[model samples]
Target: MTGGSPGRQDIGPVRQSVDGSTLSTSLEAAAARLRRRFGGRLLEEAVFRGELTYVVAPSDWLRVLAYCRSAPALSFDRLDCLMGDHLPERAERPFEVVAHLTSHTHGHRLRVKTALAEGESLPTVTGLWPSAGFDERETWEMYGIAFEGHPDLRRLLTTEDFEGYPLRKDFPLQGTVGGRIRIDLRGKI
Candidate 1:
């Protein structure tokens, strides 16, 4: 979080060095563009290790990504990856969905993130980037981060009767005790 809180829209554009090595500048420009376009919907922005990350409201997830994809200044037309992080100790929102995007036209990368409370549904971005369909399904099955509006939302790597989310930080290492078992031992004994 190099810059001050960028949640405010109305902030002035950041200036880069005249020499034109503008990784930070480009990141700021993306943040500014997002801020200007999304207004208060932009929750927080940060530049870390020359990479820009924006934390946005869950309600604005699809719209923000759509803007990044379609807007000329951004044109982040590629969805590199979609993943989830679970921090169950946080009382407010324990789940985070991180989307990595790249702009072949603009020649930069940015990470968009949104936080969701337990059981909160995430708006699907598969419509914007069809490649995210299976990734979202994997995240859903692994972390239980539900993706709303996903056309075929189902467990990608687990059985239909899987009990709990496996990737949450709080999930037990040995697995849940006394979970359901469908085995029958009629004549074997």
Candidate 2:
């Protein structure tokens, strides 16, 4: 994990609003606000399919999410999705934790992403959004992304004895072990 401040420089350029509505806030504006508040902790920003996406530093993920949830102007109250992706090709950061945040009042959706190398830990966002607990646990079990500070960080999909993250790109396609034994009581010889 790279250790640095949040707002060392400004984010992407703000384009003119297409809708021309004063109430509507552009993604650039939000990124700028977050950059100012967090100060260089936010790593990158981009727009995809009209959704604002920000790649945040791992160390600052919790702080950024907490602010986004509690701040009245930027109340990203709804955590629509929390998932993990594995990028084996990427040498520095092989795993990514993506979160989709929705602001019902503001009618805006933001995607926050934090990248992690193997064995690095990601802070849990369940404190800001309780729904994250399940997703985090699943990520932990599937991609082996350990979420620090999770109240109940445990396997949600896989068994306790399960080994290795199944979702990694390098994971084998074939099964390593069979499921539990099944007995045929009706046709017992």
For candidate 2, list the clashing residue pairs, or say none.
Answer: 5-40, 5-41, 6-39, 6-40, 6-41, 7-39, 7-40
Q: Report model 1's TM-score to 2 decimal places.
A: 0.80
TM-score, per-candidate, Cα-based: 0.80, 0.81
Which structure among the candidates has the greatest lDDT? Answer: 1
By summed lDDT, the worst window of 10 consecutive residues in model 2 runs over 15-24
Model 2 lDDT per residue over 1-189, tens place: 233235556553543233432223554566667767865566666555567667787887888888889887788999998999999777888899999999886778888888889999988898889999899988988898999898888756665566778888887889784345444569421
- RMSD to native, candidate 1: 6.8
Where is model 2 more than 4 Å wrong at Cα? Answer: 1-8, 15-28, 178-189
